[model samples]
Target: MNWRMTRYTYWMVLAVLSFGPEAAGATWHVDDSNTSAPWTGADWDNPFQYLQDALDAATAGDTIKVAQGTYHPDDATQNHTEGDRSETFLMQSGVVIQGGYIGYDNESPPPDTRDWELY
Candidate 1:
């Protein structure tokens, strides 16, 4: 392999090994169905109503699990104009945001199932 490619691979492996589950932080949840739910985002049943809420609460090494739903950028922020395209979801380094979850099925205990092909 080329020198640059070898070095890149080495660094990638090292990074993965160095930052393992020990570096992992909390896992936040966001479900659109939980509009009136608490802002905790602690679990599937009590998830943040908006994706923006999870983003705001997340720190480095944190993971945000989002349920299947249509989320608009303008829905969270009221300061910006209704149709303003400038408003966007700013991502953070080391913070993983994942979607495709079937959250809170109204069972005794909510279920957190992730199947992207469910649609």
Candidate 2:
């Protein structure tokens, strides 16, 4: 009922609306089951066991280390598009997904393949 309180509330709403989708970080990682067959973990070494899970948990700028696989929607990925490449992982706002091999699923991992980096 107070005008002062209404003014404050209006400012708060304005603040949140000022920033667009690029305001905060929001990244999605698809490293677990690339094609829904299960992470090869060949080059990954220590596979996370849940690619979609990781992606779901990731926010902006988080990089999902996709080793090698086909992450289809059947595996819980509903945001995939035709632009998505087989090897290239989806990068979102500030997201920096990395991969060992993009095409060659059987390619050997790097000697010091630690993991993908995020923003």
Best by TM-score: 1
Q: Which ten residues in a row have the lowest lDDT in candidate 2?
A: 110-119
Give TM-scores for every candidate, taking all chains together and pairing residue i with residue i.
0.70, 0.34
lDDT tens per residue, model 1, 1-119: 69999999999999999987775599998878886746688998788877777888889989999887887675563243556677787667789988888876456334576776761
How displaced is residue 33 in candidate 1, in Å? 1.2
RMSD of 2: 10.2
- Candidate 1 Cα RMSD after full superposition onto the native fold (Å): 8.8
Q: What would the TM-score be for candidate 2 when compared with the true structure?
A: 0.34
Give candidate 2 misplaced runs (Cα > 4 Å).
1-46, 77-92, 101-119
Most lDDT-accurate candidate: 1
Off by over 4 Å in 1: 1-23, 77-83, 108-110
lDDT (10s digit) by residue, model 2, range 39-68: 433334434444544555566656556644
Q: Could you tell me how far off, in angstroms, the CA of residue 12 lies in candidate 1 after the best superposition?
A: 27
lDDT of 1 at 83: 65
Query: lDDT of candidate 2 vs native?
Result: 0.48
